[model samples]
Target chain A: MLTPEHIRDFLDEVKDPEIPVLSLNDLGVITGIEVAEDGFVTVRMTPTFAGCPAMEYMRAEVEQSLKRHGVQAFTVQMSFSEPWNSNKISEKGRKALKEFGLAPPQPYQGILVLDILEYAECPNCHSTNTEMRTPFGPTLCRSMHFCLNCRQLFEQFKPL
Target chain B: MLENAIKDLLYKIADDQLILGHRNSEWTGFGPMLEEDIAFSSMAQDKLGHSLAFYTLLHQMGEGDPDTVAFMRNADQFHNSQLVELPIGEYDFSLIRHFLYDNAEILRFESLSQSTNEEIAKIATKLKGEVRYHVLHANTLVKQLGSATQESISRLQQSLEYALPFALGIFEPSKHEQELIDAGIYSGEAALQNQWLERISAVLEKTHLKLPEIANLQPVYGGRYGQHTEHLQPLLDEMAEVFKIDPTAEW
Candidate 1:
């Protein structure tokens, strides 16, 4: 008698392997869910990046979560037709990212401008007085920033 | 004939991505700044993933499994361009190579997105979006550093000159080039090279750096046919070091 809502609720407990604080639902990676009368469940997902190493781990976690919820046959399907963008990240996810010591993604403006440093508030001190250390970060979606106020170096999830 | 041609094209593309992705990943802990570290790592992951996708296609076409093909290949068996296997010397050198290589790669992916081969075209379409950011990152840095201070500009110029010959080798024609072109699987290295030249020239024009007169320059070829610099075998050895230990043990 498990419904799609119950499956979604179960998935909400599945945290992103890289950013453990954010659930897959919070990150907007889970695109769709279906529950069949025969207790089969299907989840459609998209990766934050085409090559995100965490993807396989996340898929396993999704299946584990659903199976734990007593679903008999389930499948997790990865889709790329829609393409992923940072804009898909929820507001709650942004707040979680900030609280976790990484600056959240800013609103993406069309065409990357070099001046994005001006708006990167420090996750450590919440100060706008930050300098960009590098436009590229340790991961595809992150950038390095230095807070002049707190003197702490932090990573920012760059807006896509 | 077309099958061999297609496999040749896929192997070269996959090998290039795999080797260069490994090189980019080497910057993880050593970037001058954390953002660059992450940027390279991000691009590295994307490149590696792209290689995996192509390898998967090869597997479907009856090649060996992806893990065996990627981790167990000898240096002579690899088909990556020599440019990718070169050591990442300095930020200047890596950045210049990034600019040169990605310009060509983005163009290649764009053309491949329209390939008559549906599978290749689909993968290309998915991958091209990811590479767009890599191109942006490369072009932005090249423009900034290529025109900035005396030190930065001079360093970039030096690296550009040193990397150019190897970069040109990326366009070394495949023996199956005509077959690939005629089959609409790819438009051929010559066409891609021409497009790459225009693209890189457009970016370089915005900077103080000058493009070397490529007409007189001899490309460092042979990589397409498996001849590599001494640097490559060592790199391959290092890559296989951990994988060879257990081949079956999952981390």
Candidate 2:
């Protein structure tokens, strides 16, 4: 009776290690979930940044989430077959990021330009009057910006 | 033979990233400004991650695990271009090296994204996006400083001149260069160098910095075949220090 949807539903409880408000499912890193006739499950995930230190932790958390859901005989794998871009973050993920005080990335086309890095809607004031301070941030997935309207420094989930 | 060529290409690129990542880390707390500190540190983390991806690919190609291959190797065994192994001298030098180095790196990854090898292609596709930010940072700073005060412009120009020869060495071809190119594994280093030249020239043109006559300079070769400056061994020693303390230690 267990379906991939059921597996996905169970994974909804697992949040990103760095951004706790965002679930792994909403974060768009859970690339695939499969349930076999033999009652084995396989989960595939990819990193937002290949060097993301949180990836191993996230992978382990996926395994733990499955075990806690009373599922056994599961395997978790990380790959780049479906690489991550900021566009992968679900709308729910974007909402959670904004509510968490991080500016959500602007939906970008397939090509990312320097202009995209400059456009951060201020999470505090919802202001478009912002300037990017630096592309590299405290985390590889975020960039620093300052909002002229809010007069506050903020971080944006960098659009990859 | 084709496999050797591919592995050789992968090793050099991975080593360049790993070594330069370490050098960048040295600026973690030492950058002239806090933004710069965060920038270099973030770049270090990204580069380290990039190196791990390539090392993982090399592992899949039957090399040792990423840890063993990265830590257990001697300086003489590394294949990074000499440009990456040099000491991070001053801010000017580091900035110039970063500008020169990443400009070529971005082009290399862009070209490799179309590689006939699917796995390499996948990694190249994923990484080129991340590296784009590095290029943006480098170009912005290079243009700003290359046109700033007299001292800033002169220092950057001096660093640029000092770094050019080694920058050219990044294109040192392996014996299998032709084989790799002909097989569609890679497009060859010569073509990459030409593209790199155009890209860097375009950036420098926006600033006061002058591009030296590269044709007149002898390229400093040998790092691809394990010839490194005296700086590399010390870097390797420091990098492997903790790992060597207990090779079996787990985090």
Candidate 3:
């Protein structure tokens, strides 16, 4: 029987577009997958932000993945009430982004409302010499920035 | 002004803000700088939050539930302008549009803050604070990118020129324009558009970019009439899918 574990295993190979090295499962885009007795799989997802551009394709890709595995009557449900933030991604996803040359979002600086960190430390060298290039990034989920020291371009995972 | 007219105008404003907020929210985690990522996302949240405030006024006025007023309304019913409904573009385009839109919004909100209508004045005053930050942030980006190398200037100009006409649509007239003007609810379209152009040009001139031919640009009808571009449908579907499935379900 193909259990939820099987589904998880399958998604492990799927990479998040923004952070290409991290699997969607690692990033927690696939929050939960329920396999019904009738062979229907209901995959629950939450976008880091409600308007993430990758979501539409992510939904379709999940649907196709299950169909390929011979699961019938599947649906991808995207939820928003609880909302998604950096905390949603697992420990594995954090490590993956860091190693993959992307900076994972730092934990809340104990401030309830806003974290007042001025600049991000570069993923390439961990230098705090990064300056923001664009408030909006190549995609909706990321912002554009370049590291001053290395002169290398990189994307920072935004705080929720 | 007329209550019915005010209701319609508010919806237009609310819908534009909400839809743009939704579109920009997509950039939350994916921006280039961690700080900027949060900034862009925060702006999106502000847009949506402002929309909600306006929608609540609508709900109280007997329009409908706030969520339903926002989510359940079909494509034809939303009154946001063409500029907001377009898909999220490259960073330069988004930055340019933000610079243009926020300045206009600040000016518009300032006028709204003074409306003879208590409700409009109250909401506008409340929103005035965040609107100021939005303009400041955009102005900084405009200054930086405007002074940046050739590549940045080209990208920003392309978006600025391309979207200029649709951008004008933000100041498009409501069906009851004169009533709103005579009653002191708003300054009306002609005054607002001229102000928008003057402000937009003044900022763009600081950059090395050419101002889009102001006199030739024409407004598109999307926001008031609820006709949006191709980009809005997928966004609406994703954002509304859950709520649409069960409007009454709390989630």
Candidate 4:
């Protein structure tokens, strides 16, 4: 009999299709796990955004991971009710994101301000002397920054 | 009758999102700054996702699959506004257009959230939150750049004037507009535009930019009836380029 702990362990290996560096658990997308009396498993999750394209792939990957572990019946249920926040990302995920060359998200203060430049340390040189290039980066969660010390351009995962 | 009106409404909204999303994605890796590159790409993904949602609704109504409908449509077949199909010119132009378009879009989604059709209403309600952020992003940039240096202010002012005529096309009334309004599917584009003007003017009031005289300028219409600028065909060609080559391939 596969325990819920075993299922969680299996899911921890399922990385996000977009980021790839962080697992679903690391990103805090996995909200609930239910094992029915009839041996059916239900995994509840929420997307980082309502229209995140990677969501379909994430659902499929979860089902595949559970099946690979010899689970006979499983389903991935998606919900937008709880909604996702950047604060859900684990400390391990933040370190991994930084190591992967993408600045991790900071805690948002609920005000729309361009002050991320003041606190965004350059992932390349660890220098605080950086300037924001644009608040609108290549993706919804990122913003661009320039390091004055290293003269390297980098993307900061915007605090949401 | 209601079905036809609903489909028409869905097509225009979906087409606008798909085309603008493609345009926004082009900014990826080429943004003046990494943050902007990411921002455009992020909004691009959101726009694409929103289009997919609407297309899925159409698919459920017996249209072709979302991929086929989105990837196979030609420029003449698309129903987007002329404003979204224009090439994202300079940063100032893109920013100004974003300001104008998203203002109307947020209002559109808010109105649609009350749609009599349950599915459309649910989708709109969920999407309204995302569009709110887009409006926030556009408003913030417009405010900052609008009042910044003389160069920035002048550039934005020029782009604002250039974009207004086309922006009006977003409210070009559909043929079935009356049916849609009667059925309570949407409140119609005219009402949406009135609300949009007030909302956009409020933001412009805080900036150095000025709103153009709408009564004097001719609105560029015909996109809803399938006529489009020459720019749209090339954009469609580029968008379907890869999809056409291997429509069966999964990657």
Say which prediction, candidate 1 or candidate 3, comes out ahead on DockQ: 1
- Sequence-dependent TM-score of model 2: 0.98
Q: Over 4 Å off in model 2, which ranges?
A: none
> What is the per-residue lDDT of model 2 for residues B106-149, given as tens digits with 9 covering 90 to 100?
98899889999999999999999999999999999998998899
Docking quality band of candidate 1, CAPRI definitions:
acceptable
Compute the DockQ of candidate 3: 0.04
- List the candidate 1 regions with Cα displacement exceeding 4 Å: A79-82, A91-133, A145-155, B32-35, B149-151
Poorest 10 consecutive residues of model 3 chain B by lDDT? B125-134
Candidate of highest TM-score: 2
TM-score of chain B of 4: 0.98
TM-score of chain B of each: 0.99, 0.99, 0.96, 0.98
Q: Which ten residues in a row have the lowest lDDT in candidate 4 chain B?
A: B125-134
Ranking by TM-score: 2, 1, 4, 3
lDDT, model 2: 0.92
How many residue pairs collide in each prediction? 7, 0, 19, 16
Candidate that would win on lDDT: 2
TM-score winner, 2 or 3: 2
Residues A1-160, model 2: lDDT tens digits: 7899999999999998899999999999999999999889999999999889999998888889899989989999899899988899999999999999999989988588778877999999999999988898888999999999979999999998
Interface DockQ of each model: 0.43, 0.88, 0.04, 0.34
Better of 3 and 4 by DockQ: 4
CA lDDT, every prediction?
Answer: 0.87, 0.92, 0.75, 0.85
lDDT of 4 by residue, B42-74 (tens): 889889988987898898898899999988988
